[model samples]
Target chain A: MIAAMTNANPNIRLDKRDLILTKGSEVMLRRGYHGTGVQEIVQAAGIPKGSFYHYFASKEDFAVHALEFLYAPRLQRYAQALGDRSLSPCQRILTFYGELLNHFRRQERPQYHCFIGSLSFEMAEPSQPIGLQVESILQRSVDILAQCLTEAREAGELNAATDCVELAEFIANAWEGTLMRMKAGANAAPLSVFLHQLERLLTPSP
Target chain B: MIAAMTNANPNIRLDKRDLILTKGSEVMLRRGYHGTGVQEIVQAAGIPKGSFYHYFASKEDFAVHALEFLYAPRLQRYAQALGDRSLSPCQRILTFYGELLNHFRRQERPQYHCFIGSLSFEMAEPSQPIGLQVESILQRSVDILAQCLTEAREAGELNAATDCVELAEFIANAWEGTLMRMKAGANAAPLSVFLHQLERLLTPSP
Candidate 1:
């Protein structure tokens, strides 16, 4: 949707829009939504303040787009992992989380599952629009995982009695909680706990 | 420590300090840390800006005290629940969460598990002092639960093979994740799943 808008305005350079969003999200991720300012983000991106307004209607609008901007490729990767045929359904889920853990482990500090977790936490109350966007994004992720879990159950890898959507919601919520802890402690031990428990959580029922 | 300071300085009124913290935390919870200002907090507190400074050295300092202030009574209640003699150890753990869920359910809004959860989400990266305080609070909670699980094991209610501390951390992290979801969706369904999964997660291993 935003891409259409960018293309419609021939004056708006894709690179510049991307630059503002990239820098804006980085600052927002580091300092949080309320912690960041439009001028600061424009400065970080080496763009004029006017250019930010040219591309975005308001700080809130920028955030809504920033969220979609940050999520697009990552969601693609997530969707791909969920549907990967090379691995069994259960294997796909575990391996996906394992790779994510390794990514966070390399940082040696709390990462926000790429900042969406924090934005959602920060936005949910203050800005209804962004909160709605964040919730929708979360639901998208949950839907992806639920689809994978559904396959797992059908393939006899998950418990036949399992409700895939509910389980997916639990795993996603649990992972979000683990990220909150990781941020507070600046440690990844909770990530380890998340992964360990993820295995137990996915085991088939008797 | 703060109580001692209050007693030593007859100039400072306990009720005034409490007012600032109570109002400050409420604003901070509704607005992200960076979203709020000392002026706004003081105005809401119905106190002079000087009063806020007298009790708290800085915004960071105020947040640290606020974190401590918000946590004190809740921690006391948590310790009580963990050590509650009427219920079995596992029952104590589950009942504690059940009661908390009911509290959030009554509000019809996503709550912070009493604001500490959101503060931890917001404070960790931007402010070191507050982050450390939040981590310590989380550690305290995890410790209480771990102690309860230890008793549960001793009473033969838990799987003997269970690593009580690790499991406690997982449960704590998972509950935090659950709360994050609750805040995002403004729904209590996640809480039900947390309770359901808590039972399964706590079940003795084969």
Candidate 2:
């Protein structure tokens, strides 16, 4: 599907920018940053090769923006989910997993979760700059969740002894690893089982 | 540093088969399955495209072998680590993480944790056959660890009430996620800290 390009920088004439990023995101999410070709992006976006160069200085430039474009809203949803007043901290965290499981089951059939993570791993081998951008994007989300855990602890909603930073990192990684296992597993039980065990971990024993 | 390729199969010609798989392993590890080009693999292997096709019917065939090539040793080491009779089951598990942490620190400079979980994420989208191969590799490792955990429980090495399957899954994921965060953080402490916490979880509290 060709999404119409929206210009974020009018002075820069980024008319084809959004189209490139959208198409590129699809390809990269399916493939990966190190594995994708600008030619493929141009072909997928239905833009000329020359037009791709005109819109972005290089493939790396487009990928950095694409990572943000692909991940920003997902991170926002994460923040919102963590802040949900109607749910307990533990419930909200599990709800985030539920939402992700729903995404995995979608007809579009995304094979993985966390593009920032995928790119971080693929790019870590070669490109320092790209790896940093992806890591910062992930860390930002981790920081937000850590803050939520802090708030939950203060509200007497979590065990006071729980280390919020470690817990946040744990939840982030559990989700990340769960997605990988889910895609790799022939069955879906791994995802739900991980979540159930996580709930058991977070819930205080009476 | 280029390593000489050794053929594991006697029926296959050693030089040609090793050339394709060794180079293919590097490309897939560095770029991922879909992101890598057949041309790139052939060039790196210094084999003609025809020679490449002579050994493997398709990229999928090459990828299946590459996935196996990448993970087979790691799996062997994991089994050895679990089967070491000198160490208690809990200590064996801790030693496994310790050994993995050393590998992470050593290769953290050059993006060392190559295949296993990394490629699993990248190929999750396009390479179903390769994905299955990787999944089976992971599942087999998890099964081995689960068995160790079961032994630990039966031998009274852990709390009799400890859920072996869940704990094994958690330990496996902690390593996967910790590698990513440590890579992102550019520090090894997170990996060690996770191992420490895991040991605490595994120990029998009086």
Candidate 3:
């Protein structure tokens, strides 16, 4: 039946589209595109497949859009967190970690394993579009962190020797790697350890 | 016919079992288990499906063994690198990175994305057994690094402030994350940047 129905309703509200994106992101993050099916995504979203294709061109297009959708709110949250005027740059950095940890822990399904990293891993050899999408997100993420680090550096919140761009990439890499360890360990302690170590590194030098 | 063919002659000089695993490891390391098929493995190995089952109980079992086979040599190489008596602890640490970078660059496959990390991303939620195998490898890899760090710490080669265990874990996490970035960016410079930052962190203060 046309390879199963997709959520095909253009008139659908943004909420419905987000719902599809959330469910689709989860499935693709876990089983990957080749392994996931439209039926499964629709079932997870509690929406018909017709509603899905209406919102997306194809599985590949949906995956790209889903990543963008998922990242938008996160980037917004990060920007808000970094913009907090009450907290110092270092304190805001700490708050960022708290927000991320809380965000992941609250998920009923812990499959939001960094869309960029997950898709990059799966699509490295198969889909150039997916890889390009992932790279774009990664670059954006790195850029955001770099901006924060640069602000901190300008404020003298970080060591003067720190290279903002490199440290930003390092933090981004650490976050991705820590996520892997947490998922593989199926325990949160590694994440806690990472944050603890990160805080220790960020603690102002006496 | 069954989902996957599994039969082969037992008397072949080149044990079809070893051949299958060797070829299968190459395929799985590159394409992932779900992304590959028994036919592809058998065809690559020039063996029949019957020959495959003669050595493996199932595809999962074959995967488990293939991973073990692939990783054991790596563990040995790491051990040797960490154990090098010719270099000081700090030098040995740097040597490990040098060796890793060289191996990845010189390999027939320029993209030697760690099999354990790659498979962990693809199979973490779907299969607990495979997940456990990946975890064991990760733990072992970290432990090996920790041992080197401990030796370095004891030898007074690292900054007194560095916690060997935590630093080891950090290094391991950084390396894994760097590999993902390297693959995503299709460039090795990120890895070099990571190692350079790490060298600064690990070097004893003057």
Residue range B1-206, candidate 2, lDDT tens digits: 12334444544576678778887778777766666778989988987899888778888788888778767887898898998989989889988888767876786463555576666776654667877897788778888899999999988988888888877776676667767776665667667667766776787756
Better of 1 and 2 by DockQ: 1
C-alpha-based local distance difference test score of model 3: 0.75
Per candidate, native contacts kept equal 0.62, 0.47, 0.33
Tell me which of candidates 1 and 2 scores higher on lDDT: 1
Model 3 spans with C-alpha error above 4 angstroms: A1-10, A13-20, A37-57, A99-112, A204-206, B1-14, B29-31, B37-40, B102-110
Q: Each candidate: what lDDT?
A: 0.84, 0.75, 0.75
Winner of 1 and 2 under TM-score? 1
Regions of candidate 1 where Cα sits further than 4 Å from its true position: A1-12, A110-114, B1-12, B110-114
- Scored by Cα lDDT, where does model 2 land? 0.75
lDDT of 3 by residue, B74-180 (tens): 98888888889898877887978876677666654346456777777777667778878877888898898888888888889876667778777777887788888
TM-score of each: 0.91, 0.85, 0.84
Sort candidate 1 into its docking category.
Answer: medium
lDDT of 3 by residue, A1-206 (tens): 33234436434466787898888778776665566777878888999889888778888888878878877787777777877879887788888897677776776545536666667776654666766777677778788778777788778888787788888888778778888877776666566667877786674454
Best by lDDT: 1
Model 1 chain A: ten consecutive residues of lowest lDDT: A108-117
Pick the DockQ winner: 1
